[model samples]
Target chain A: MLGIDWNFAGCGCGVPQGKDVEVGMRGLLVKDFRFALQNKKMMVMLVVIEAVFLVMQGAGSASFVMGYMMMGCGMLVLATITTDEYNKSMAFLMTLPVRRADYALEKYVFSFLCNLVGFFLAVVPYCVLRPDRVADTLYLAVVIMAVMLMLQMVMLPAQLKYGGERGRMVLLGVFAGGVLMFTWGRKVWERALAGSEGLQEFAARMAEGIKGLDAAVAGIGAVLLCIVCFVISLSVSRRIMEKKEF
Target chain B: MLVKMENVEKRYGDFTLQCSLEVREGYITGLIGANGAGKSTAFKAILGLIHTDAGRVEVLGKNREDFTAADKEELGVVLAESSFNGMLTIKDTAAIMEALYRKFDKDYFYDKCARYGLPVEKPLKDFSTGMNAKFKLLAAMSHEARLLVLDEPTVGLDSVVRRELLDEMRRYMEKDGRAILISSHISSDLEGLCDDLYFIQDGRIQFHEDTDVILSDYAILKVNQKQYGEMDKQYIEYRMKEPFGYALLTKQKQFYLDNYPGIAVEKGNIDDVMLMMTRAEREKKL
Candidate 1:
């Protein structure tokens, strides 16, 4: 009578996936939070670590060094997750009436939650310690998210294909090497400017000009990048899983 | 019928498993095949664990791929390997499954655990292979499912445990509407429990018939080769003939029985049928 076709393909087996049928993310939210209920000890342990990290990074002024360390931790967690799914725990979960799409969505959303918690903790110290840099703290939040989102883009596909151990190793190596090279380039530029009187003044003027743009633009860019990566990853991973053999 | 696979075809690299099958309600159907013969692959496809390249799997008249959580709750599975998280105790796994499956039966879970002497407090990792299989069965049975899919459920269990598992499955079907699809290489179990048998070979269903029908229809006729040389090859599924004598499997056992009253018409089992079919299937390729 409601004209809702129980046989509707879009609802269960249709062009519009049933998993995407509603605004309600109860399924996603439930699984992301299931660890809290299923393993209370582990949840308590993670919460304690977050509080400790927040205290350590007070004034939330996270350095590039802090960013690198968090990325390493993220890589390690993703590795463990992928190994559990592929070699160890997958057969059991797959046998149940769980959908592949829901499974993939949980991985992406939960890992993002992990990064979100880490980023928030990193800035909480600065937000409370240095109220003046609250705005900077917020900006740091966006940048940390951008870096994590990019890492996810690399990890999800690799984990889905080759899986955890090797994928994380490659991602961490690539990221660390790339950042180190950039640091080397920056230090070389600093030495070049220090060696020349004219170049020093010119570099100072350029730096001032570059810093004038609104920090809000960085936030906007990071948010947009995250949205794009999340959407593309979800779609691509769905296709890969739909066609995957096991 | 509880489960039906129509013209199913699955190919993984060089391996292929093809068959059309149906499992009626109130009966246990044993999916018999050799190792690497695609029995597990077929069961996986039926459970929607692995997607078949072609064909449809229907459960309770609804296609398996179209199932929801509610639908899945009514269809239980006990894979060879336990699916419960290693860190979780029997209680922990039971609690999680209870939350996840709407029909999860708590009292039934405890009763079965107590009956089987499974330690609810023991971490699942500490259980032996036999104990693990029992717990998996307990979890599945707790669902009170209309259909149960078991993939080599008796793999590591001893003969006594294997019989106990089969007996439990049989008791579950006493309600007269439930069904089960059991895939195992153990032929004696098939003989003991299955109402119907499906023999798969080389990815194609070479033979599928009633258990009693096969038992009555086939016989190991021991006859002198000189006399058997003039017999019809069309009726012979297999004939191990030599200069001394011959042992043959004929579909028309009654015909041979009536014709050669003096010849031995020993009964063939589900295992003998499997051996003959798989052997003949391989000999065809050569």
Candidate 2:
């Protein structure tokens, strides 16, 4: 038995039978997860990079290493999109029984899972080495995850809209712009704060305000913002996919 | 109708594609066209890949705008390029497809791949062009789809593999109500496989006729200047001037054969009809 069921008993009109069976969003997530699993080399690379970061940074810099590793995982998520475009596999995917909305949803879920796993992997080493800092590490992980999600939210749609090469260039431009703004803004802030005692006092009060803020509320707000970004990004990607031609 | 496109329009800047066609149950419709004749665009519209500017597209009896994932499950598609991710092996692809498509038969897919000499463990990028083409067809066939839409499926395949693929298509049609819509630049492939052929040029369908009618009734008549000018042009669909004479294409071959016994009338294949119809000046009435 080769599992070749060539039964042609039904109306061969190609019309899907009564009440078209819809695969739920969960099925789409599973399919995307399976697709991601196929890239063994990328998974191995992610693990190796995280291990290297963990070892080099050591226990003292656990938060920094974890943040870097989580960000790395986020980059890997974007890589998957670029890889699909480069290989022109999106066309194949579009032909499948999955809707564009499902595809967009899958990307968001898959990328979130990947970043979560990366966060967990980073947390595991820190937990083993610096058990006392577990709570602090968890808080830092939430912040880092939020940042990663926001970055992904921006990058995903741009990649889907522009494709591999142009998308990478656009991502690079965004990164460069962020770095330039950070450096220039830091200098300007330092110059302003150095001359003005009032400004310095205000900055001190702002820092105190941030430190006094409720951690749980801040974490919840960050998560909510990430969710909002995810929804918006998913919608934009779906629209891009709808207009795309093979 | 299995698939229908009514006044489907897609425009990219100045290039506009306006097409209308149909694929009926148990029929194989061939869309024959030149390289950029909008065949792929029409396919994209039918599959709802690209948003059309205007017109209605219905697939499997449902308007394309309303087609759900389950509706798409009954339609198998193979594009001009190998759409498989290059990093994925056949095994991985089968897994992904099984997860995506509820009716996907993994064992049957593997069997078909094995029969086609496609290595199950190798990534698609490692496969040759012919192997990739065969693998795509095999994947499309493994799914028990009622409508199979193939675009340039046999382009890189050798004659033997092509014949085998065509035979497989014939076998696929054995189940009543199954239909296929295939597009190819190679007209000979369609000559033997297609039930009806639609000739497209410059984003418009020039003509559509049954393969039997095309083979039996259509012809290329070779005549000198004087004879071509003197002959009744009523039946001549198109005429192209050659170095030595004029090659005229007519739908009523028997009429020309009966009336002008001296004229050289050759039985028209899909290619001859496409060439003459595309390049020849259109008749005022048609």
Candidate 3:
């Protein structure tokens, strides 16, 4: 007969015990980072391609080139999340000691870290070669990071709510809708500006107003908007994960 | 109890899962059911992977909702499917597990991997189905958790590997306060390992008893039409009609053997019990 012990204690596996939320969060980050790092070959290929693009495009449009490269890095972050879902590994991940909230926190942290790496790789070289473009490159990097964050804000929740295949479909639909709206809005604006002197004058005034605004204040506002989006996206992703069946 | 589900309920469109069972420390509890019999659903509910409509789930003496990361550290879980990312090599997986689990025995994990003939440098995608299953089990066992929740952990492994895994489970249970809740369609695996068994059908538990009692007391009575008509209906748990006669399932095997002079009574295994019970449920509906 098998021995039956009702006691909860005395299971001496020599493992440490205690609930350290920081350690749990760190564990989740490490896991996600390791997962992202497994694509080192792909990252290297992207770096080689970016180097070619930088040399061909020249330093005149360095900020624009760097911003485009960072965008690809951001997409890699999304790809890692999608890959986890595609492999059905999220089920295993959730069973670990980490909470759903921690998983969301780790994704944002991982994405931010990847973006930082991309920024350094792209901007540092340009800054070293052309010191005059430091401020411009820095500003462009921030804007690119903000845009990437917003894109992830939309993608993460959709991916968490739906699986990979359907999630990609949803992302495609959003992108298509945005392109259609942009094209239609641009056409309307052109028609209105061509026909109406008052409307064109108002547009010119708006552009002037934007240019006249303090750069520091605008930067602060952009950072605040990104922070707000990050918080909301994390909350949405957490809720979706909590409700997920598998 | 290491794990407890009290009146747990989950509903998806028309199918409902309503189950309650307990797994005590230092014992192996087997959950036996046919495919799509809500066995997996019950396991998910206990793990809080799915929202339960009503009832409480308690693990390691605390409500599942209140379970902290520390509590989870003491749990080892293996789902029906491969859980590791296929893109990762075994070395990468070991790194992840070491980070995720504080007590993860890295050496033990690698040793098991080597013993199982799994290449550590290759990505998991290169592993065969049986290799993947063994890897998941190895990962779970490497954690030294107090409770192990395994769903179909031995599905794709050969007989030799399956027996080795079962031996490992027995060794795991030898530790005081260690328990396992395992669900599998393979009845023979559970027959030798489980201390208690729970038979689930539709959405509810049809039977929960000690494995010894199930094997010793439960039986199937083969009878002709006249004997079946005369046999007491109270003792028959489930009945299936065949062209020859009827196979009647009953818990009171000794009672029938003593009462009936020469009725064909054969010991019922887990499979026979599940089939007869499910058939009986369907027959009742008809």
Candidate 4:
């Protein structure tokens, strides 16, 4: 799915040839999807939560639903990594025709698909309810997707490093730490700017320099940054998988 | 050789495995050893599940580092304590295997599943220990792998199911260019199954011999202390102080029979060979 065509027939090779790396990765995705589906309670819970939000918030709930489902599905994919660890099955899975890199890459692809599914689920209902706001909803969905992807960039590696249960705690700690630092840093920035004319001029110039850029260029820059973050996250996860032993 | 390990070593605190072995095409090679004898460690090295601290491990004619995903498609592996995710149904496992292995035979897989009485819809966690073993074996074979590295695949299985699995392995070997490296604590299974056997103890290989040679040439000679002293020790390999007197292990069954007709010479099997190799003192002169 990530630039690898699923229709392998054109390659004129079958399992006997075993030349396709993508096929093994496809298998990993299927296994992960199967595991995700096994959590029927979570699936039902997502539906109920969406219905309740829609009823309570009306059309205003579209953004909330989008955020909730994206988080829900992304988390489900992340949890599959832990399921692979259960019964030491991760070792056995590694024995298959998939490389460590492919296994790591598959998680990212699966995560993106889960987020896409969540986006589609939220958008379809919102569009039906408020057809005139389709463009606005799409734009909001893109912004939310970017944020969710950035979160995954942090979360996936954390999950692989700390494991399933502990990884969640680690993610919480990181988020809490980031929030505290941001608040304190903002106060320090304002105080330093107030105390120094030089710093105030530098800060204004920095803001004027960013504001001078075209909106399209800024959007492209943000997208490029997100892609770079994703690639780095995938690399970190691959290293983790390579060093892991049964 | 389909799989080969030479002077391989894996150290875990006090236990370090220094082993060398090979699995040739068309041969079922048995890694015979007691628990913690490093059989699983050696298998893990060959399968690339764990890294070796030193020496070489080559599978499918390539060093593990050079072996790509395509190379792994030709090899199937079963670990001693792990299988497919327990949350999956047999059906789900089949689908995953089909995707993972290019040559996965779903029909043959389902046939084996039915033969082993495995319910396709049931979660693997719900399977009995023996059923799980059967499923693991079936999954490994269903892909038509050229080399199958199995670590204790028959554990938890009863005699009947064990025999059935052996027969399945036999059938698998009927095809040319296929081989299996299996480990187990059950001696009779290896005696009847492996073409050649490597006996390991305390992270080292004690002996490697043809299964037929172990069964035919090896013998355990029970003798009183006086008889033990008087009998020829030229063919003796190991000697243990039994309550009756001294129990001798020798590879020359005919030599003792010819020299002393009255001596008790019991034919050796895998168990006796392992028992002597691990517990009995080596006759250093031999």
On TM-score, the candidate that comes out on top is 4
Reference A-B contact fraction recovered by candidate 2: 0.43
lDDT of each: 0.69, 0.80, 0.81, 0.85
Q: Please, what are the lDDT tens digits per residue for candidate 4 over residues B246-268?
A: 77899999999999998999999
Error of 3 at B269 (Å): 1.4
TM-score of 3: 0.88
Question: How do all models score by TM-score?
Answer: 0.78, 0.88, 0.88, 0.93
Q: By the TM-score metric, which is better: model 1 or model 4?
A: 4
Candidate 3 ranges with C-alpha deviation above 4 Å: A1-20, A175-209, B229-234, B259-261, B284-286
lDDT of 2 at B270: 91
For all candidates, the clash counts are 7, 0, 0, 1
Residue B232 in model 3: lDDT = 80
Q: Which pairs of residues have clashing backbones in candidate 4?
A: A15-B102
Candidate 1 chain B has its poorest 10 consecutive residues by lDDT at: B277-286
i-RMS for every candidate (Å) is: 4.6, 5.2, 5.8, 5.3
Q: Which stretches of candidate 4 lie over 4 Å from their true place?
A: A1-19, A208-215, B282-286
